[model samples]
Target chain A: MDSIIFLRPTRGLAALNLRDLWVYRELVYFLMWRDLKVRYKQTLLGASWAILQPVVQMVIFTLLFGGVANLSSEGVPYPVFNFTALLPWGLFSKALSDAGRALVNNRNMITKVYFPRLVIPVSSVLAGLVDFAIAFGVLVLIIIYYHFAPGANFDFHFTPALLTLPLFLILALVSALGFSLWLSAMNVIYRDVGHVLPFLTQIWFFITPIVYSSSEISSKWQWLYALNPMTGVIEGFRWAILGTQSTPALLLIISTLVAVVVLISGLFYFRRMERSFADEI
Target chain B: MDDIAIRVENISKSYRIGTAPERYRTLRDSITNAGRHILAARHLAARLSAGRSDLARSPDPSSHSTIWALKDVSFDVRRGQVLGIVGRNGAGKSTLLKILSRVTEPSTGQAEIHGRVGSLLEVGTGFHPELTGRENIYLNGAILGMKRVEIERKFDEIVEFSEVGQFIDTPVKRYSSGMYLRLAFAVAAHLEPEILVVDEVLAVGDAEFQRKCLGKMSDVAQAGRTVLFVSHNMSAILRLTEETLVLEKGRLAYRAATPEAVDYYMAAGFSDAGERLWQASEVPADAAPFQPLALRVRDPKGRVVDTARSTEPLSIEVEYRLDQPITGLRVGIYLLTMRGEYVFTSFDTDDPGKFEQHSTRPAGHYVSRCTLPANWLNEGRYVLAVNASAFHVKRYFWDDHALAFNVDATGAPGKHWPEPRLGPVRPALDWMIETL
Candidate 1:
């Protein structure tokens, strides 16, 4: 009653149909809500898994790097340093793995009705924010523990840099969304892409400087190192939260460019593959 | 043009089955196939340069790789009209609906809709097992393109209709399959779009629930909305639809008033080989002594055919050769409807005196036949199973589905009635209205 709809066979380079996404925004919200509700269902510990996964990893890394390897945490305690990086890393990594399976997982909805297929992976990537938010609370508690603990060697102050946290958080989200789009769409055609995701994320984790400081790397390779989008996000996130040395502005620009390019290209690739999803799925 | 709700123009779809199909294709297979394609293309190029006539004249490789599930189908639905789609399996009914609903893009041509279209290719499409019944209602409503506030307004009606109000807060995975179907159809029925395209969703669900759904669909159609219904239930098609389209093998075979279309579609599937000649290999070694020869379906006019009008009598005659003397041999035919539901079984010796005292049979050529009276069978395909045996004696031979035929009951008694007849037989019983 509102408007006419025309459906035609597409040849090449179809538009993203951003209007359909806007109209079906409610379904997106419901799917995201569904994922969040179902994630903790039937679990004895509930949302604690989000907190437990990162905290346990932080303890392991702290004992291995700070005590045995004698790595420098700059001025911050090793636990806070590693935990800060873990928060954004957790967000990115969860977004990757979850979105990789999101299309194949929600194939029931995809083949049955007509909606923007982009909604599935987008909502899947967004659902990780809930887990990240819960895990973030632990980071704040750890920061407080170091601040007020008796005989603590670390100094804690409210720096002006704290205001930059939201910006870096947005960057981390953008990077996750960008990479997730590639994985979820390709996962539809080549199913083995899912098998490779674990190894891909594992290698991606080591290169992002989560457990080690970026200063440990040789200065000559900085440009090549900054090619990784997460390096910018994780480094920027650490600087904002812990008041570590600020990342070079050039490195931040390169990382943001990579994130934006991946996002735009992922959108293009996703739109290209979306028309065949119903048949393939 | 203004009153037209949907206009489909020459739409077609083809699916490319790359290499062979699996649940999902792996990278190793795809990469290797890509390498093979490159080599194949190079070979083709070399052949073309040498002017190989056959290679130059071959059809496009892309066309050979894809199968056209639907081909050049077009139709239009006027506003406020309920149109039914009838087809046998693999007839492309589901494919056409999927195309119009935009579940997949067509390989060619296009369709235009002048109003909002809500298609239910399946019920309970987006329901999650972990979600409670109440939550799934909201999720399913949103998935069907209903606003949250719209679902909130109809929430109680949906719950009441599903009859799961007592267990609304429970997870749907815990609900029985019947309860799940009821809840799923209840949500889909409430989607009040201007054009509703439903695909045989009523085929599941219990009779009471199906009646409820039909009643609701009648309400939807009566409210001046366009509806496209695809179903194998002929009675439902006759009851709800004004016009119908018949598809055969991805092509539009017929379009007419609902009854006429149903008749044409039912009669079109004449199961071939109606007169089956038994070969030596088909018969088992244990029944070597009794050689079943031939079976044929003959119309009332004594002409052989694979299909006949329902109002006409049809006969089944089976011929055979008995190699040796067999005592108490009774050759019979089992008349079954398409789904293996038996209409009746008749033997040459069903008559009490054992067919004029021919109890003991001598070895020679023998023929046994039975005639189904006019106006007896409903319009559908029926399979014939043959048997040769004697009560309390040795079983000689048996052949399941020895032959098949079809019948058309366009003018069966009570044709004016809306409700469906329950069984395979349509008896023309005598009825009269008496003044009290």
Candidate 2:
């Protein structure tokens, strides 16, 4: 075990020590476990609250946007369309806020010990999965509940298309991790990112086609709308689960491209700022 | 060369306070000054506003932008050598440890280590009170750079040493503070890496716990592992380390056997013997509510002197002015030896009646004095450090380098024999030489 480790100042995006990140994968798992463990202290209320939050949001959107504004859900009842989008959207938003604050919240570990700094934010992003799984179960129940009721007719069968559900879920996480990487790193130097996060998430929610189907948006701006990666994630989730009318090939292509680009750039930006974190944070 | 466990070559670190939290950056500032000005421009603006009036004011004394925490410091430690590092506060001791642990990068140069490294900057660096003692051991072990198998292998020993086996599953929040420190330290002690970087771990805990830590550290040293130990506890250094490095003002001041290094390090704090004073400019801004003014030593003759006789009581006095009323303030002195080992500590309000009478000290000029009994100290040099702080609250001022004085043993017990005194204190004993 005589590994001669070398130390020096990192420069110019050369600090992306993915090997270091890989070496401490156990720490990554432990941190993720700790977050999950400490998060839900009261077991029943914790899981219930996780499902309760999205169900309440789905109801509000169905009543306000679905009923009052006469927004089209492509003939599917408003609740199923809205909740389907809410799953990925909820997962994405949680990653944005939670991952963004992970570094600042663990300043003790940063200033004290040596580990791959990326593990902190990355673990929080992944830990959002547990909450996502809880809410997803509720979404399935909502789908079945609406199917048997009057005037609400969508199915919840295990289709070959449902195989793509995990893919869209992964896509939502990729897009979140992208934006989160930038926000968390910058949050270390300038705390302005923390204050700006809520407002940005609010606007992002309106931009993504969460309340209404992507078919309602005018074609001229659809490409620009897909620039926000969550648009494709929400749209893709509806098609994969609900098997919505049209295939969103163009939307998927644009959204995936943007998410991959942001993730790569965010990775570079994070590594560049990684060296100063211990001192600056 | 092959036996060297760590090789640090010309390592240095410089911190720009501009980026640190001290120079808080708001969103408005970042937006308005986005690219046109970041560090350089704003620094110039700050200087221009401070003006040119105070020419005699010290330049770059910590607040003026840049500080080099370590300067061209280099060293090598053989595979089984335990090295001690001693320094005054801000002497770059902790910064050096930070660099070697890879917690931060050096601004210049590099270091190579040929073994698994474990750093204990503080006991329980990431212990969550919500976590059980058993769980915290695993979590804390992982954070301290221990592998999963390592923690699993040593789990039993850790619980046994901590002596909290019965309560291992209880949340550490419920543990007494003493129990908490014990459990945290237990995990750290069980780390059996080839190399260790420890910082003042003995500084916490009670006297018994400190002794236990000293015992554990000696065991580590005796086990033939390379260790870099930094501490202000001179006695512990003398006991555990064979060699020591002395750091002064961010530079390597001296290096030698532990005894010599400790003596030099302790004596280096002396600027004068009879009296020490701090000027208005010398006092740190944070010490505003209470500022240290002066410390003086006087002989039995009532004359301020640098040297005192062991046969007569000596008086030590501290003078200061408090700008505001304070509660629970304890103005105390720590008496130590030339090797920096503690003799005893005394506070002006240590007496219960005195503490009750002066529970709240009003703002004004004050003088606190105490006397050391005659025939109490042996012939040697000693150091006194002053502290003014409220319990568990704000620390107004502290000066470890406040004063150093000499004590002479004369006309005491066994004066006719002319034998050298053996320990820190010299006590007069009543003797009866009857044929019994």
Tens-digit lDDT track of model 2 for B184-278: 89998888778888899888989998888888877887898889999988888888899999998788899999999988988886775589988
What would the per-residue lDDT of candidate 1 be over residues A172-211, giving only the tens digit for each residue?
A: 9999999999999999988888899999999999998888
Clashes of 1: 0
Cα lDDT of candidate 1 equals 0.86
- What CAPRI grade goes to candidate 1? medium
* Cα lDDT, all candidates: 0.86, 0.86
DockQ for all models: 0.59, 0.73
Q: Please list the residue runs of candidate 2 whose C-alpha ends up more than 4 Å from where it truly belongs after superposition.
A: A42-44, A156-158, B18-23, B27-64, B280-284, B433-436
- Clashing pairs for predicted structure model 1, backbone only: none
Please state the CAPRI-style docking class of candidate 2. medium
TM accuracy, model 2: 0.93
lDDT of 1 at B189: 88
What DockQ would candidate 1 receive versus the native complex?
Answer: 0.59
Q: Per-prediction TM-score, please?
A: 0.80, 0.93
